[model samples]
Target: MIARQYLERAGLHFYAANVTLRGGELDLIMRDGETWVFVEVRYRRTSLYGDAAASVSYTKQRRLLHSAAIWLTERGGSFDTTDCRFDVLAITGSQLQWLPNAFAAAE
Candidate 1:
């Protein structure tokens, strides 16, 4: 919720949330100008396992990519032509970090 609020404050238009298709779930989806953003939200109380951002491994990225593809395909309309990117919002304790274009679609 905090991440969604933060993103809204940053001027992105809300689209969808918890979009689960075939592969995985997208925490949040929003629009930034002409770009579509697929977001991953992560939280960690401590950095014992390299913090929340580091938790998004390559395998996770692949899943996210697959899910995004399915989401777009299912909801064609403008989404088919819109530019899209993956983003990560990580919360470690009280700190919040937003990483734009966190990863690309897996090959």
Candidate 2:
């Protein structure tokens, strides 16, 4: 809900939510102009270990990239011509932070 509201407030069009591919899942997908924004939502009650954003480790990033590629393939779009970005929405307590292009799509 937080992530969707944030994207809506930013004027981005919502595409899909909780999209599950074979490898992984995308929390939210939105269209930011011509770019497809694949978002990962994370929530942490307390930051004792680390913040919510910090939990999206290297492995998680790779899985997201793979899933995104699968989505494009299934959607029958040319990846070379399409623009895509990975975003992260971190919710800690009452604070919500949207990190655009939080991680690269490379391993």
Candidate 3:
């Protein structure tokens, strides 16, 4: 809810779809201008293991990327441009950090 609230407050209308069947989950999906964004919502009070953003490992990124590809292929016409990104919204306590282009090409 906080994430949606933040995105709404930021003036970005979004779609939140649960894609657990594919084993790749997207907390929220939104259109940022002409760009399609697959967002992973994270919450970590402290960085005991690591910051929430930092926790998106290569494996996780690959899964998210795969799921995104599936979504694009299934939706058809939803993605016109090659401009897509994996974003991370890290809410550590009361602070909200948005990481754009959170990862490079999926490995």
On the 0 to 100 scale, the lDDT of residue 98 in model 3 is: 86
Tell me the whole-model lDDT of each prediction, alpha carbons only.
Answer: 0.88, 0.88, 0.76
Q: Which ten residues in a row have the lowest lDDT in candidate 1?
A: 73-82
- Tell me the tens digit of each residue's lDDT in model 1 across 38-104: 9999999989778899999989898888888888887773334769999999999888999999987
Error of 2 at 23 (Å): 1.2
lDDT for model 2: 0.88
Clashing pairs in 1: none
Ranking by TM-score: 2, 1, 3
Model 2 residue 16 lDDT score? 94
| Model 2, span 1-107: residue lDDT tens | 87898888988899999999998998899999999999999999978888899999989998998889899988886457579889999988777888999986653
Better of 1 and 3 by lDDT: 1
Ranking by lDDT: 2, 1, 3
Question: Any idea how many clashes model 3 has?
Answer: 0
> Residues 34-82, candidate 3, lDDT per residue (tens digit)?
6777888888998787778777777888888778877777777433445
